[model samples]
Target chain A: MNNNPYYGPEGHGPYEMIDIGDLLLEDGGTIPNCKLAVATHGALNAAKDNAILVPTWYSGTSKIMEQVYIGAGRALDPAKYFIIVVNQIGSGLSTSPHNTGGAMTGPNFPKVRIGDDVRAQHRLLTENFGLKSLALVVGGSMGAQQTYEWAVRYPDFVKRAAPIAGTAKNTEHDFLFAETLNEAITTDPGFREGRYGSPADVAAGLKRQAKLWTVMGWSTDFFRANRHKALGFESVQAFIDTFMTGYFAPMDPNNLLSMAWKWQRGDVSRNAGGDLAAALGRIKAKTFVMPISHDMFFPPADCEAEQRLIPGSEFRPLASIDGHLGLFGTDPQMLAQLDANLSELLATRVN
Target chain B: MNNNPYYGPEGHGPYEMIDIGDLLLEDGGTIPNCKLAVATHGALNAAKDNAILVPTWYSGTSKIMEQVYIGAGRALDPAKYFIIVVNQIGSGLSTSPHNTGGAMTGPNFPKVRIGDDVRAQHRLLTENFGLKSLALVVGGSMGAQQTYEWAVRYPDFVKRAAPIAGTAKNTEHDFLFAETLNEAITTDPGFREGRYGSPADVAAGLKRQAKLWTVMGWSTDFFRANRHKALGFESVQAFIDTFMTGYFAPMDPNNLLSMAWKWQRGDVSRNAGGDLAAALGRIKAKTFVMPISHDMFFPPADCEAEQRLIPGSEFRPLASIDGHLGLFGTDPQMLAQLDANLSELLATRVN
Candidate 1:
């Protein structure tokens, strides 16, 4: 295993670029050359037998997942296990619509699904690292959707899986939030059919999208406790200004819109014959379904419901007031519980 | 007392209009020529000692209060008590900047407070109705603010007071919500500095203001459970369109902006030396403070805190999930509770 740093300041990451030379499509059309990024870490010497797969969330890159990698005592600890993290398509750090050799730029990007993301990751693992997944696949939120897809798409590859803070099916309320954000972006006058436009104008739409997030991302109790102090202004205007100023301070407006669109179209069961129950049942991996208790978007109820549908799946719930952001907040008690359970699972090697 | 229906469609009920010719102000100015609509039900002669003063909430009129008066077994049941409902100034049905013989319009209107509202009600009771004392002053929400102000300003004129779902002083959160709504109105280009360039344009601003209310007026759970059916639209866009259509259909934009401005400036103790606790302590009326448990704007904690400061005051929290709307939703149960307590107090009237 190499300890070389993956991500450099500007662009270079865990996944090295690979050129897919021009090929003939199924429709008898010539397809342009494309390059994909593939990143691998941990014990590749043991081949696929010691590998664990990690998929990226919306706008996240494989390098971002490096934060979760550990040398020992952690879920993705490299001391005893190999961890493979992949950047999903459409993410700027990977093979995205923005940099697809003029084929999928702007509004021309093809709609991709969780299955497509898992399929691409599987190819990278098998073709580049010579890994046939043997250990576990773990992810949270949208990443969890990819994890679930991996279990179903390659049942023989994944021995165990942990999908946290995600649902097999998106609820109506989830659709509303996602759709609203999508509209806020696309409806901007400068969107120009998703083509060239002022990045600053696009930033305004992103700010509006972020405002909805600031409201829904936290629990009501959290907002009630810290709104005035957090924003440093008494009125809602202050809250809006503070939120917009902080969220867009470090991110590109185009990148924000791209990620928001991906989130809006995210639906695991959309391609699973619209039968989430059947899809979960097909997962041969021993699954640990853990959900954050107070997650406004994907609550414990969703995971509990999924657990009941998947045979032999263990259900664990992490209690935190941080809502969907609990995975990022890393509550001590929640992390300890997760660490203990994951360590025991890996130690026992029950497959 | 005479029974005459004041405003609204003719012959609906009894309403009496009181004209206050002129009141000299301490600041060497004349108070706006004021007219009030008073609605009375039941025999004031038989239950003259049992008469209760009920003030309307912001934007509410005598017509709306009539529902509370006639509600079965309510605190102001016309069958047993003489209920005198007074419309607060600035409401369209009463003396307002909109219809004060064109005296004060748009930006020319004076900033009025709860004390001013209570004072006007006091004049109507004393000079027009020939009443020296009220058995009780009952109100909810903004109406409750006026009721509390009456107790502080005219302690000797009121015996007992019930202020529901209201705070003795506005909290920062309350100001934030009100300020946001006001900004949503005034910032709209159509507002044109309180005077719209076009009536239709002003109406659009009102519709936008109302949209914010529709969202904040209810709890998140309520919207999630009812948005589909209540909005009568399948898609999110359709739902928002339906909502905006209904909201803007009947409201005058100017009226909405003016009312929101009034609400923004609604500080009951603004004149009380800026000391909220001291202002509350000045109230001499025996007070029954009932804040709705789930009222987001005026939570039970606010009323409970105020109750601790007021002498001879009792806190009775209305346990309901309707939030600020609990003033109307807390029907039979709230009515029964108030009746049981007020009946006991009325039976032992001091006069």
Candidate 2:
């Protein structure tokens, strides 16, 4: 199998890969030689308790996340606290369907879960960094799932958690959205049952996937008010075409499906014997659930529901008209709000 | 070139056809020998003032509308009023991309608009039915677009209007959803730029379209609550396969695109010099704007925004967790509420 350039470690500057080697997943599947792509900002304090963990979201690499959210005085300040952004499996940089050396590539890639990602991240921090616990763990969307998993599974290891534009338990709406993306990729003629000549061969399916994302990703104001103009685009079609093509054109379809399945099946409740409240109750970390106001997928109501289940957890709505995509710091006002909220949470004393 | 069975008028029960030939459209295109399919119930009063006009929705025939909302003791009863269900252009029953004769069929079909449909319906009621005005004009989705157009374009002709699960002006969210559907059809390999041998050949594209509809057409609760089991389907896929295949498999892709474009372009403000509030001010009818509460496409909030602009209009929320497709009267409770709302609106003494 040829390496797809879109996801390999070629251009991932400031990003480093660590060889964990032969990791067992939550689903009982094992990768022969597991590797994780990660990035770090800031410096670990002498006490080693100043590390923050930031998980990469779906369709995003650590480099992209660092660019969008991290800065000197931002919520994730490089100088204030050490922030480690770990790329999840199925993202080609890590041990994904595309980069696996031997027989486990494409459809042969074993199913991985959010729990598995947290487990690997835990090992990376404990064994590699010698960190006993994280000061805080925060992320948006799929990254949020990992945040919740980290808080719940290793309750003592994460002092605080922030899940933005996502939920601990995947909602029915998100499950279906993930399923639709899977269908778009699989039904493409170039898919050929997960054995394609190149990622570009399934361009039609990727285009369809992009179209679906365009509808679900943004709010009414995003298009009606011509907000794409704010992004320096002349029209909605132009922005969508450029963004979708740029994002999905070079990605391997199988890797996408693998991640999508994991996203759909995300639920911390299963770890607590199918009890959502119980799972939430076990999260001893100081929690903050942040949902975008106009998000069509994860509405404020849904986020608040999850937040209410977590005792003493704060619920803050990210006021933005960009819907689910608002968390990308597209609007400066929202980015400021995000930073303020995160700073406040980080500064909160642990009782 | 080949006759497809789903659209032909072989079994259009109670439905009739009329020729309003050679019509000019709002988009400056003309449909030669333009035809409209219609169905009527109840007798026309001697004064012709008891006529209630119902326009069919996107991808809908008069039969489907009748099945969904029309019956004895239902919201739209033919016995108490002369109910006229007019199938809009672009539906196969009318002068659509599929049914147009000779070279005019398929891709050659002219672009039609909501304004063009309102104009044709005005002519059909005036010339064919000898009706000077309508007691009430009611519809859902695209049919709702026509209802608004009728009220705005010919205020004197419509006394009351009921637009359920829809809005007078399409929102950006709905526009994007419409675009997604159009993309699904055109991207189908069988489309062949609208010159396909048969509708069934593009089964892959149709499946993708069906998947999208499955995601957007219903509420998350509709699936999470296993509502499909109530419809006798053991699984979600079973219901989607049975429903979508049964609905769109036999459809001509061009016919869908024609109606989708019309639905997307629906805007009453264009008549009032692009002023929405001013256009709504022209509505002399007692308007009842009903939007489904959980509808992802046309949320109650969005509907209420438009409803607030109409003079003395009542904004009623259809409290359903079933999202956009709730208007079909799928659940009996919602249907009862719909019937009661319409009954109350019909009984209202118009100021």
Candidate 3:
């Protein structure tokens, strides 16, 4: 690992900061200058032969991903593997609408596809670290989408890949949820067409959106078990009050809108010449597709459909009631399954 | 059997009207004095000793309740029982904000409770049809709440009661949903604080409320299965278009808001001494509490909790994903179960 001190807080870590201005698309496009913050662990000098790539999900950062790097009996144990986690572009902590240097901010931020995120991360790996190929690539949800993109966009770079709780193509149901969230944000008069509006207007819209999400993203059984503890107040008003004061209370309305817009346009097929099946078929990586059965956003059927397109791709369905949240909540079980399957594939890496 | 024209269409056809000036609570109250649209099937002359009283859910009427009266070889049947379907007060077809005397239009309409609804139905049964007591009281959803009220408020008048997909007390979750719908309506600028506004404003608010209901009142599995067939449009806009057009395509905004308000304030114990359990225990009628297992609004757990309080009360959970709608979804298995249970209960009824 590089003993770089300037990458993060003083005396904090060994992660490096890499600027990828060389990978920008021309015309001062909104997606240009996709500078990234990268972190490496285990053995960085063996990048070409021993490197594993990890991409962050929405709102995730290198610091958060580092937690999975060095734990005992963990999937990515530092004692056994070299892990490189790259922060995705537009994830606020990285190159995002908030700090795009007069480029894309507010409503002018251009739409970004999953390809753009992976392409930028790829450039950071090859150009900065001299990593020509990866031993493995693993991610969950949007992270999974990026992992799939790495296999498709740079087939020779990835030997084995795991995509958890996600699909190769965005479904119509996914679009509907994204649209509803966007409508909740943009329709609020306080949004001022994605510009200036009252803080109260922004808060109200955020609270409303959060409430919708809490209902759809959680199991009714979970709610029945945890409602009283989660919200100490016994009345419905108290529940709303607790939700507004706790979860949506601190989030910026503009940030919420921007993130929702990004999520809505998240599809690798959008960049794959509009043929999702053909794109999945091109992935040469030994792929493992893990789907959560009760996921409200992306059901296991979506993953099964995608698996059918990728020859030899292994599909695993998790029978957890955590829904989409199982990707995070039950990570230990998922990681165990992933490690057992990928160990054999990694041992057979061509590089 | 009383062959009175007042018992069927001859009594209250789709277009038939009868003056209700004397039934007005008070001049200039929120509720207007409107016609009582009464419709009965089975035997009217024997109604005093054998009538089965049925009420309607929100946005429903006597026309809708008439279908349930033909209870598939169950407790309620035209061949064996007299059925009197009463249009709940405040429903547009009955005394309501829309057509009460000119004094009770729009915002002027007073909020009515389940007790008020039962009282109005009682007056219609005894004064108009000369009925002294009902052999059974039956209803579903909000109508079921009225059925429960019939047993508590007029204990001696109702011999048997069937409350389907309902509970003795509304939970915080139930109120949370109702409150959200109310906020959706009141927040629409066009709602004009429940006064006159643009047709578009009223329509938008009503549509928003309906959308929320569609999400909460059905399981995610149901949406996954039927969203396409129900909406016909593949995109989100198409779904919204179909939903808005179909929801208020034939209804008045004032009537919709008024009925929603009634549902929001629905509480069997609101005026029954603030103790729903005690009120339920006081019910003299033999009660059957039927709840739909997958109902997100009034879940079976709520009804099961209530069953513990009522002596001799039986609890049956309907295993349907129809949520609050299992009352209309004719599952033959559910009907057969209902038949066996009710046959035993009705055989014990005394005139």
Candidate 4:
């Protein structure tokens, strides 16, 4: 794909960058020479209404998303809809601690909020595409946070919203888990104020982080049932290497920490005078809150609560032992269900 | 408290030790002149059948258990029965990596099993106290593993058994969680292959481990309800520092790793020719299996499954949102229920 080791080749389409310059952050710090890495598929029609926006999740790149979810027969079919996968700020492919220029790179990068991402994406749509509104805004995990933010922050822009395996307001357990991830990185002896060279410097912490993911990202059934074997892994270590450790090893620790902090502090409530109910009330988009049944990070009950607050919002709990990783459609049956749900949402008319 | 950093001084009556020289570990390694640290309260009656055994849990010593659960009006009332709290092999208070001699000290300590603990404890009961049997064998977490092992390995030796907030055999999730804990230490750059000069060398890893515990050891409600404030901490950081990081800071990383390995590999089924049902069927005690409702590590369902297999076992799931830490009776009401349950189990008649 790109020179960045954090990204894999073949999953994402052609990469493009847009510079906004010297973007301000939530914590008063700034990321200079602001750039966003984006990928696109299918041509935008003259009507422009067929454009669908997809945001990437934690440690996820646009290409991986394309590889997993985009296809002719998939819910996110590139043939039917103009698909745009935007990499988040801290993701190494975009303006990140690893790629960004200036003193604010690495640990010095300010804490960016979910709100910032929504705002930046809005600019990209308005200025680059000159699109008035999106047919759909869909995402999973932290990407779900952005989807919810889009619906609430610019409700008129997102006609339909699908947030999977994540919540509008992160649960305390999620916050604590994110904190652990960040701590695992920052506390590594080789972290050295986030100025360390090479991923090997923090290999131990990255391994530890991957191990934690083995427990949280998937349910007990994922291991006991040897689901990794189904994914073509010879053993659990192979699975970890293929997905967990290998995925994170090349990542910049500072960027990971930055993203984790944003994930933990994600609160749409802050926009509605610290009222979560009011925040959900502002969302005009046709919302479908989809949560994986066994997702430890974002339980169905948490997602259900948000869906209940939004008028006409649907609550879909995906019963998958794959847990949070179900966001990737680990089961083809799950992908079918997602296709059906998306088709239903896209076909429905709402004023 | 025998001046051990792993223990508190006020609650435990007195500390003692027993030499079981040249102890053979489950992994076929030996610790020369092995000594087991123990604490005792009340009196061993003339019949020597009035003794209650309590094995220490992970990162816990006898005095700490005394500080938390033992008292005049407590379920673990010293005056009612002779209670012997035996620290596990790798517990710093016992013959651990921190105190063992020669090659067995530090990272060189051999892997020990729940079976090995039961064997050593049996020797202590027979050779020192002249006790033919224990009136009750009760424990929590890793301690619970030993409790279950006691009921199965020497079923006739334990008249009554209560294993709380833990499972007889580690589940896939539990194994992953244990592996994560060990990896947190082993991957620490300061660990220097587990031959670090001081605790500071492993402070970063231990902090990361503590952070993980904060997420998994407690439930979502525990943090959302701000129960840490009930325990006198003002903030989550304060709570994590006081109850988590501080609690683990003094521990030897090698000992923690050894115990974690033992915990992950604990499967009584091996004794029954790899049949879990057969192993549980061997439990002849009047067993009361208590699992915390919200324990992510050891779900109540897993504990229920084990209870169903053991004949004459009473399945009692503790209704608490405190997760695994409820074993220390985090809430007063939870403790009251535990007291009532223990009293009921102790008073019941069995074959």
Candidate 4 residues lying further than 4 Å off, grouped into runs, are A1-11, A19-24, A29-33, A42-48, A102-110, B1-13, B20-22, B44-48, B71-75
Q: What is the TM-score of chain A in candidate 2?
A: 0.97
Clashing pairs in 3: B2-B45, B30-B108, B30-B109, B30-B110, B31-B110, B32-B100
The residue ranges of model 2 lying beyond 4 angstroms of the native Cα positions read: A1-5, A8-11, B7-12, B28-30, B230-232, B272-278, B349-351
lDDT of 4 by residue, B1-351 (tens): 112354333333368878976677677976666678888888988878779999988877787677777788787788888999998988876778777666666777788998888888988888888898998999988989999999999988999999988888888668888877776777777898978877778898898788788888887778777788888889888878777898788777887887888888778887798899999999889999998888888887788888999998999888887888886667877888788898898888765
User: Considering every candidate listed, which one attains the maximal DockQ?
Assistant: 4
Candidate 4: which docking quality band?
A: medium
**Weakest lDDT window of 10 consecutive positions for candidate 4 chain A:** A1-10
**iRMSD (Å) of candidate 4?**
2.1
Q: Score the docking of each candidate (DockQ).
A: 0.14, 0.53, 0.19, 0.56
Candidate 4's residue-wise lDDT over A255-299, tens digit each?
788788889988899889889999999999898888988888987
Q: How many backbone clashes does candidate 3 have?
A: 6
Clashing pairs in 2: none
Each model's TM-score for chain A is 0.83, 0.97, 0.82, 0.95
State the displacement of the C-alpha of residue B71, model 1, in Å, after optimal TM-score superposition.
1.9
Question: What range of 10 consecutive residues in model 2 chain B has the weakest lDDT sum?
Answer: B1-10
Docking class of 3: incorrect
lDDT of each: 0.63, 0.84, 0.65, 0.82
TM-score of 2: 0.92
Candidate whose lDDT is highest = 2
**Candidate 4, clashing residue pairs?**
A11-A63, A12-A63
Rank the models by TM-score, top first.
Answer: 2, 4, 3, 1
Better of 1 and 4 by DockQ: 4
